[model samples]
Target: MKGLLLRWLILTLAILAAAYLIDGIAVAGFPSALAAAALLGILNALLRPLLLLLTLPLNILTLGLFTFVINALLLMMVSGVIGGLKIQGFGSALLASLVISLVSWLLTTLVGNEGKMDVIVLQRRDEDHWE
Candidate 1:
């Protein structure tokens, strides 16, 4: 529980920093930033996977680039849900989403993993006879 909360806190800070970078992804202040983070998380959880699935053909057609547009749309939808958050237009949304993705990827890389969780073993270490 504590670890989960801590991870959420880290994510909140990342989102706040991202919103700072993007002009239209504003929150009134700290409180609003936190609220926006929560809203963003909820939307991503509930909507993102579905959107990805629905847009799979388009995503493949664009060699995965269309996923960026889908992500931007989700971010804009988040702004719609949260009062102080706003993404001006699709172009702004696309730019902001790219910025957010870059920042979040950097932060996640810096932080590393804190627990055992669900994920594919994309690469496996070579095995030996009890070595």
Candidate 2:
């Protein structure tokens, strides 16, 4: 629906911003960046969850830090899918991923929480409204 498309665009913009902040995250232009963003979304949707599940023990052992590596790998895979989105090397990809995540997190989290998105605000008119 329209909401999904909007979210996709927002994510694309976030990635584009992140690319500007970090090295090795390349897109030729706006169109290329958009395409690469969509590809990244697709790759994350298709692959990331499985990787997380497979690496659950590692994730647990690492206190969920291993998820960052998985995310970086997914970003690199996305670069491979989108021809113009080139990551120079694994380390670069990892660093770019970290930057991308941090930037996106900061933007989305700016409304209220610190580094947490998907936030919903509820206004209470009366204390009894929650009952």
Work out the TM-score per prediction: 0.75, 0.76
Candidate whose lDDT is highest: 2
Question: What does each candidate score in C-alpha RMSD?
Answer: 6.9, 6.5
Instruction: Give the C-alpha lDDT of model 2.
Output: 0.75
Candidate 1: C-alpha lDDT: 0.73
**Model 1 off-target regions past 4 Å?**
115-131
* Tens-digit lDDT string for candidate 2 (1-131): 65456556667777777678777667777787788778887878888889999999999999998888998888878887788787788887778777777766665555333323465677787986742
lDDT (tens digit, per residue) of candidate 1 on 43-129: 788998999999899889999999789878877887787787777788878887787777766666666467334344454456633
Candidates' C-alpha lDDT: 0.73, 0.75
Query: Alpha carbon lDDT of residue 44, candidate 1?
Result: 80
